[model samples]
Each structure stands twice: as C-alpha cells, then as structure tokens.
Target: MSVDLQTVKRVARLARIAVSEEDAERMTGELNAILGFVEQLNEVDVSGVEPMTSVTPMEMKKRQDIVTDGNKAADIVANAPATEENFFLVPKVVE
Candidate 1:
C-alpha cells in the first residue's frame, strides 16, 4: 500500500488538517514508511502468543460495585452559581 502526494492531500483534507504541497509530499513518504513497517510486522509468526494489556503480567485490582450519592448535596449546591429548590437554574430556551 504505497501512498502518493494526492492520496496524502486527500487524507489531510479528511482529517481536517491543512498541508502544503511540500509538507504533503513529506507526509506521503512518512505514511509509506509506516505502512511498510506494518507490512514487516505482519510477516512475523505469533501463533501461541497471548494478547496482553501490559508487557508485565499482573492482576488488576478489584472493587465493590456500589452506587451512592456520598451525602454531599449541600456542598455541591453551595458551589453552583444559581440554584432553585435543589436544581441548577438555567435559561429556558423552549416554550
């Protein structure tokens, strides 16, 4: 999968990035290099290798799944700029 200048320009446009003609050419080369590296990686064999989140094997910490408000309603309301009867007051848009 070789990338050309036009392809690079299209990719830049799709990603909402502004690229000059010279920069587009450079980016095209870089993209081709990355794709070449990916192709090289694809040639390697990994039949029995297990997928891992980290290189070092370690158990993830577990916690109880409890849902609560933590009893801080007054403190939360004190920080609000405008509150009315336990609710934040905002400008009504719809009639």
Candidate 2:
C-alpha cells in the first residue's frame, strides 16, 4: 500500500492538520515507507505464536475486596451546604 500526495493531503484534512505542499510531499514519502515496512511485516509467519501483554513474566499484586468504611452518614452530611435527613439538597433547575 503506497501513499500518494493526494492521499496525504486528504489525511491531513481529516486530521485537521495544516500541511504545505512541500510538507505534504515529505509526508507522502514517509507514509509510503511506513506502509512498505508493514507490508514486509505481513510476510512473516507466526501461526503458533501466542499473543502477550508484556515481554517479562510477573504476577499481578492482588488485594482482598472488603468495605473499610461502615456507617459514616452523619460525617458525610455535615460537610454539605444544604442537607436534609442524610441527603444533600440542591436547587431545582428543571421545571
């Protein structure tokens, strides 16, 4: 897949990037080179290779799922500017 000057110009327009004719010409070559490299990579055979998230092997740190806070309703409601019966009251915006 080769990138042409028009394709580069269209890509720049889609990305909302300002590209001069000279810059567009440069980008056309750069994009074509990247596509050529990707085409080369497509020729490699990796049928049995397994997908991995990282190169190094390590176990993730685990933590016990437990609720630490128990019944702090009064403490939370105290900080509210307008609170009524363990609930924060706000101005009614919708009619």
Candidate 3:
C-alpha cells in the first residue's frame, strides 16, 4: 500500500501534529518505506511455525492461588507517623 500526500496530511491532522507541506511530503516517503518493509516481511515462509513470546524457548512457571496474611503488620505500621488501634490515623474531614 502506498501513502499519498493527502493520506499523510490526514494522518498528521488526526495525530495533532503540525506538519508543513514539505514535512508531509517527507512523511509520505517514510510511511511508504515502512509499508514496503512490512510487505517484504509478509513474503517470508512460516509454515508449521509455532508462535513464540521470545527468541529463546522457556517454560512458564505456575503457582497455586491461595490467600494468606503477609504477616508484617507491625513492620508496616512502624513507618507511620500516626497510627491508632492497628490502623493509620488521618485527620477527620467531616463532623
């Protein structure tokens, strides 16, 4: 697919970019080059190829989902400047 000057201008307008006429022309060429490279990528053979998350093969680790207290209440409250009844104290905003 080719990007024309009008298409480039429309794209610039949608992106809220301040594109001059000369800059739009330059952008048209750059966009066309990127599309051409993507077209070239489409020509590659990928028959029977598995999709990969990375270049190297790796097994995703699994863990059981269970809820438990982190057991650091005292440590967490230690950094608070004002705490009362095992909870952080904040200034009252309403009567």
Which regions of candidate 2 fall more than 4 Å away from where they truly are? 13-16, 61-95
Q: What global local distance difference test value does model 3 have?
A: 0.89
For residue 6, what is the lDDT in candidate 1?
A: 89
| Candidate 2 pairs with clashing backbones | none
Local distance difference test, candidate 1: 0.86
Clashes of each: 0, 0, 0
Between 1 and 3, whose lDDT is larger?
Answer: 3
Pairwise TM-score winner, candidates 2 and 3: 2
Which portions of model 3 miss their true places by more than 4 Å?
A: 44-95
Residue-level lDDT of model 1, residues 1-95, one tens digit each, is 78889889998999999999989988988999999878876777989987777988788988788874577777778888999876788899789
lDDT (C-alpha, whole model) for all candidates: 0.86, 0.91, 0.89
Pairwise lDDT winner, candidates 2 and 3: 2
C-alpha RMSD of each candidate structure in angstroms:
7.4, 10.2, 10.3
- CA displacement after TM-score superposition, residue 70 of candidate 3 (Å): 24
Q: How far is candidate 2 from the true structure (C-alpha RMSD, Å)?
A: 10.2
